[model samples]
Target chain A: MRPSATWRGLLRPGDYIVLAASIALCIAAGFGLWRGGTPDGLIIRAGGEIFAETDLSRARRIAVPGPLGTTLIEIQPGRARVAADPGPRQYCVRQGWLSRAGAVAICAPNQVSLILTGRGSDFDSLGY
Target chain B: MTHSVIELTPTDTDRRIARHAAAAIALTVAEAAIPLPLPGLKPGLANIITLVVLARWGWREAAWVSLLRVFAASLLLGQFLAPGFFLSLGGALASLAVLAGAMRLPSRWFGPVSHSLFAAFAHIGAQLLIARLWLTPHDGVFYLAPILGGAAVVFGLVNGFAAAALLREKAHAG
Candidate 1:
């Protein structure tokens, strides 16, 4: 078919329906995400229990008892990190800083973990 | 050897499939080289070849070319049997199924643009499903639907216009 000849025929009412529906869905979803807001604080878990919930805006440090020993957690303005861990590998300490909601750091040997919670953050964790 | 019972010659259709598949694979590789802003967000340039082939020949030809492109591209990218390969395969199969169904729609009512849009949605939707089922198994993954859907709408339109332009050019040349 000639390009010019079929140009007018490319779109039909059904096409408009699909486009409109998708646009509506996109807008609604975007609005929802926007309203969801950022996480307010961080949640710390140790030995499968709630250890602490600290406000992200405040700068503080806490030591939580774990299987191996104490796991020190540090929270600063909009960020949290494992300041120190008694575990041998120090994997949790190596996790560095986590500022975004839904970010998590685990010290498996110490049975201590930190999770960031808030609005707008999606996905429990990322996978390959 | 007195006589050969089976013919092993490459027919015109076979040659055409090879050419189209190669072109599509090249496009796929080239696209992979470009850095993406986010994971699972691509312009899907290779789909243009599939669109054109579907329009010029038929769905069967288009399917063969599309599948061949996926396999060849995965092998070349060294992602065969990996998570990436499975995601690509799932997305391609879903899009092909969508295109096949979209073919039944009236040609005047459904053109390259509509077909592209449908296929794009199907591709992303299938990938997300696979990710949820096998990869992540989390509800959080669905949160990306809005972003991915929006991208699909934009790229679907762009690819559709491109395919249409290419088809027009080929028709004029012939």
Candidate 2:
């Protein structure tokens, strides 16, 4: 193999350590999932509402007021999309819809939040 | 043969540079292709190529390939200057620095697989830092999950295998 051919060779020791730190992230994500083990749930906050309630196979196009501004969110049977408007930015619209449990979209700037909680599954709040 | 310094002709050098640029760009594209259930999480697949290039070619060349890749990816994804970009940059630079230090270690102590695992961990660490510093700071510290760390280990191994495939091709050609 060429000198640079070794993919692992290209990485330094510190790289491994740095990458290992993601273990923490993984743990947190898993914890979020574990504690939130039920399907069909809802999370209401100051920004907006996030729910993972029904089957995504029969969703339809729905207009919504995002925190940043006006948006057209497509709620498909199993997917959702946020359309961009004349707001300051449309990054959130570009984010598309989230399908997985615990998946959430929020426009903090606009105090608008969307969460699709698990469906048919109980909402388990580990603590708070 | 291993003890002697590796030499290259001018043409060979040019070809090598071309290959690195091509590979880096490809990896950058690949990295963007994979999506997570969440907006923030990524497998960091492109870092695999960057890691291999850093290990074999050294930090300077790796820097060139990775730096350009990041900028190009950001532009393509329309995520320039977005929090996502900052997270990626912080992780990448930190990984480079870490890889640079590891290069000094005895080769017998590790293998390509180990190197990949190391880089994966580093990327995650820097990502966390970015999340804390730039992204939402409220309860940001909770972002760390052992599952993500485990994913890094697994993905790093997969990336190592990818780099190894490239190596085999290079060896065959050279």
Candidate 3:
């Protein structure tokens, strides 16, 4: 019932295989899943509708009208943010610089939101 | 009016299962006292008892001990039927499923270490899946996979060694 006369016997070949495979999986996920590319596009939604989809390569300011008022979205060369919103707290404005893929800024009271898109979408849908 | 008495007698196997489950539950309770930075990150010291039981008895006995430990420990920890309880149940089921298969592997090459490692990986994977589907509902939960996987590997190996040593000592004694 014992692998050896001593209790301190080294791991078997199958044990080594499992350990190696587990380490390999850990390394693969660590390196593969975390390197999200910089976002290149931004989608603006207002009043539960798509206001505009623009490329992040351009630097411009777009004002989208909603139920409350216009929410100003400022887009830089590679990032976007809610520069101003009718929402009192300006929580979306505080988000500041949506540069990563799947990054989002929502001005709930203004009914406007901005989402940054990279080479690919990181999630199917997101809500706060 | 005559009252009939129902006799309850514990079988040998029942007694054995209870003994092993008590040990596993003790480990589970003792392990909870140690503080860790993360919520779900546990060394899973109780699983060493499971591995030892599997090595000594069989997978059925191990499964019984494992499941009993989860339920009993949850009750003892006052987390019964809570989110933490479901997570523990999910993990225990997943690890038991893997061990059911791993136990069939050739014992010469695959023993407590291999079974423990595979079960640990399955344990975390199932816990994360349940957390994502039921609790967090966000794919971002997967971002914790690498860190959890690392812990699984380290703790699984350590527990496997502990189980192997216990089995060796038992073999020497018995």
Candidate 4:
């Protein structure tokens, strides 16, 4: 149905004010949340238990005991990665580096996982 | 066993609400069939019926239709009493509250478009709050603010236009 001429008149100054205010609010809040800082450390898990948590600032290499064997994790200045995996696929090793909060890498066969965490990480867990 | 015949006749208002509720529920069910790339993102097409009902029959009838649609849709989708149901319930109640307030504005100042937009934001905002409090309890959930808010605006405009068109058709038919 075509909007009648009166329909266009439905929006008044007050409506525009409300709409503009809400839009601005959303933009501000969204940007502010997006600008949050990066994570500080990585939470490593093996065999469904927390294996270790290492600061991203300190570069180190650690081996975590897993179901299959040891999983090697490397931490750099501001990033972390699964350097090697005893698991068949080496899937975790291929996940590359994780520098941002909420980034995660897992070796399902070895039951080892790494999750980035920091104050800037906004979500507790990711949902698809 | 003895059978007693009983006839229950619904009033015009009841029938109108029933029809509106049914329409809203149909939209909800249809929306569920569409796959969304992200969680907490929906077109909220059923809200169009709420806007139409509020404009035509007032907030009371609209509230009935909206609540009925939520309850019925959850039951049909087998999400009753689940996290999804609570989220839906929270969003519906929050949107209804906003619509109730928005209705106080003069018709010439606020129509379906503005009302729908306000309700859309309220719906998403309430859902986010509920998710944070009960479902996830993480600050990261707020990361969805931009995407969900953007969707709310787009879907709100589309639903509002549809509701306005439906209202015009009703006016013409009457």
Candidate number achieving the greatest lDDT relative to the actual structure: 3
**Tens digits of lDDT, candidate 4, A64-119:** 88778888999998888999999997777877988778888888999998998887
The structural similarity of chain B in model 2 to the true chain B, as TM-score, is 0.80
**DockQ value for model 4:** 0.30
List CA RMSD, all candidates: 8.5, 15.9, 6.4, 7.9
What DockQ does each prediction reach against the true complex? 0.31, 0.13, 0.47, 0.30
Q: What local lDDT does model 4 show for residue A99?
A: 70
lDDT of 2 by residue, A90-121 (tens): 55565675555555655555555555566433
lDDT tens readout by residue for model 3, A1-128: 47554544747778988889999999998877676556878899988889999898878999999888899999999898899888989899987887777788889998998998876456543434
Docking class of 3: acceptable
Stretches of candidate 1 exceeding 4 Å from the true structure: A1-14, A31-128, B1-7
Q: Against the true structure, whose DockQ is highest?
A: 3
Better of 1 and 3 by lDDT: 3
lDDT of 4 by residue, B43-149 (tens): 99999999999999999999999999999999999999999999999999999999999889887767688898899999999999999998999777888988898
TM-score ranking, best first: 3, 4, 1, 2
How do all the candidates rank in terms of lDDT, highest first?
A: 3, 4, 1, 2
Q: Model 1: what TM-score? A: 0.65
Q: Each prediction's Cα lDDT score?
A: 0.86, 0.62, 0.90, 0.87
Candidate 3 DockQ, CA atoms: 0.47
Show how many residue pairs clash in every candidate, following the order shown: 1, 49, 0, 3
Local error of candidate 2 at residue B170 (angstroms): 2.6
The TM-scores of chain A alone, one per candidate, are 0.68, 0.45, 0.68, 0.68
lDDT at residue A124 of model 3 (Cα atoms):
44
